[model samples]
Target: MGWLSDSPQLLILKDCLARRLLSCHVYPELRNLPESAQGEELELADFSAFLAQEVWPTLPPSFREASFETRSALPDDLDSVPLDSTPVSFVDTLVSYGITADAEGAQTLLRKVLAEYVSDACAAPPVWSSTRARECEICEREIPLTYHHLIPRATHAKALKKKWHPASMLNAVAWLCRPCHTVVHQIATNEELARSYHSVDLLLEREDIQRWGKYASKQRFGVRRG
Candidate 1:
């Protein structure tokens, strides 16, 4: 919060992290910052402004509303001052208020915040959805379900492609939530799907898939969906 502006070292670290994000391949223009930032003479302040103004808009739908405020600072005069033309660094603003953040202490504090953010994200599901009708046979995750073609649809499509044969196994379908569906497709090949892994029971036979489903539940203890 206040520390974000109070700690010069922390602000610099955050700017560095954001720069790495800018050079990510997903962004078209700034994929190579060395080339893109060549004429700009951008420093940490420029990048922070770029992140909020330029980059924030281009972020995918999932991250658009991400809150950058880690501290509770008054918003009364924020709109009056232009962020880019602000005369000095954030640390200087804190100095005006008699606040000081040591570099070593700031670095340690930054790491703790970062670690907590990541840990909290991983330890629990961020958002939850439900199918409402039924549970997944694999993970038992209650999210939306789709009718999976237990015998790979690709196999059915291939038969139609090569010999003009219609889909023969019309009854081969399973109810799977999104995550389970993804896991099933990922762990098994198309040949395995048509030959052996054609039923929910057979799929559960693979110890790894079963083991994974067991741990993927919100509780981290697997629940079988019969």
Candidate 2:
């Protein structure tokens, strides 16, 4: 109960309620309550009604409709506005929707939401851009990109049936240029790829891939490696 006072989202909610309904009352007046049990029940009912009618509609549909467990999974579509690069208008929009009263309040509330929801997937949404990378993620060459499935597609049916990999990762990919992409599959069989090198960082950890990347990065696009 006491901890509720420290919650930024709840505090924002309280502020919105105070601004709309209790502007005439002092802070102490809020603490003062009716002595009778019946009066307390009446007050509780009125507050509940106010929340149902006034506050609930102001929330985002996802926040309002989803259960906590459901909300815990990061949605495929997050606000494209990168969390690090959140503009003043982003905070303003949340405030305007009655989500928070100020930028600090908005940040606190959003950070909590992101921390809870982004766990199963990325720590946070991709920050550099919402669009796909123009350069190869492996060699960093500016060339046409191809999708390199982290868990190679050949293993998808078996992986799904065996639960070796989560279904969400079937489409997981790193954008690599043609040479680097060719080098990857050439170095590892599909089965070994699914087991050992499921991420770009893991692929980079191999000395052969690292050496190839260094060489391929200096060569022009489509140049064959000897």
Candidate 3:
């Protein structure tokens, strides 16, 4: 386990495991490795075999047969090359095989993989302001300059809170203008706000106002209508 720490090789392996587990479409060779083999020691050949079987299958034929020697022949300092023409690193091939040292190293690889995933996922054109204005969902105000999830993400469990995952109940968010957002919080406690969030009608109906009014009158005025 200690050996895996800071090991880029191990990080790649963990990333491979994560992709496999998530069913992210891996090379057939990699998919063939036993589930238990994840996080376990592996010979380079065994790792290579897994990659060939799993990862290689999904890649283009040219990529599959690409010679690492030819790819890595560029000068050591890749920055010196033009943006459109940088040589690939042989180290990348080794990293992809998951022959790294340990779990910590695996984390590093996972971060890189996730970063790529984020980049790819965000490649779609950004939401145009004009288009957003036309389709904005929030009412009683212009759509918020920024969207905020109703359920504060800090309350969510660490594992399920991914940047790329679609927002949901466990991840409920709201889009509110700056003033409305502040007033919304100031008007109610977190628990009450969370409850009121069950429906837009409930929130807009000023049910929170009624609830708070009753509580305040009972405490200060001693004038309960009921």
Candidate 4:
């Protein structure tokens, strides 16, 4: 077993890789960072501090207590089970961490996480239900609508280090038609839209012109616009 103290470099690298995995899901631009980049040297203490301060709180309590040893010990062929059973708030978190698992297991975990988060996030209260049939964002087609997290759930799961709860980070979304949904992600992923939609608050806010403005203002990669 690799003790946290004995293999600080390896631990840090693994943590960085985990973070990058999550980032790729949320920030399309980050998907391009070389997988090798995750191996770059970083102080274990500094990385731990970042994880504790920024990442831990976002995770469900079960994962909060998970150690590198426990994770590494998980069987490669662990059967597909309900994500809720894993004790993580978001399904994506579990899936991301389970990347080392087999392909079938990974897909099972990813689907469950995505479905659960979407159900919870978009479960409209009675009052909001009536307004769900508005036109889509791109083609303006009138239909039953839902909020699409501009950041993909897979990506959001990794970025927030939390489950894919819409209520928890609703700001990272867009009011889009199903067709527009695809368009928006394409725009966000390869173009500048991902950077523009980085704000946690605006993304969660009710999709409106104002929120889009805030998203637009911050649309550059690696730089936070004031």
lDDT of each: 0.47, 0.58, 0.39, 0.39
Residue 177 in candidate 1, Cα distance off native in Å: 1.5
Model 2: CA > 4 A from native:
1-131, 222-226
lDDT by residue (tens digit), candidate 1, 1-226: 3334322224433555445434434333333344345344343344444333432223232222112221223233322322332223332422332222443332332234333322322232212133223777787877667877776766776633442222333235777877677888888788567656766888999998889788766543336676
Q: Best by TM-score, which number?
A: 2
Look at candidate 2 and give me any clashing residue pairs: none
What is the lDDT for 93 in model 4? 36
> Against the true structure, what is each candidate's TM-score?
0.33, 0.43, 0.26, 0.25
The regions of model 1 sitting more than 4 angstroms off are 1-133, 157-168, 219-226
Q: What count of clashes does model 3 give?
A: 20
Pick the lDDT winner: 2
Model 2 Cα lDDT, one tens digit per residue, 17-119: 4343342223233233444255543543444233333433444544333332345544556654244544565566446545467888756655554434334
User: What's the lDDT of the predicted structure labeled candidate 3?
Assistant: 0.39
lDDT of 2 at 62: 47
lDDT, model 1, position 2: 37
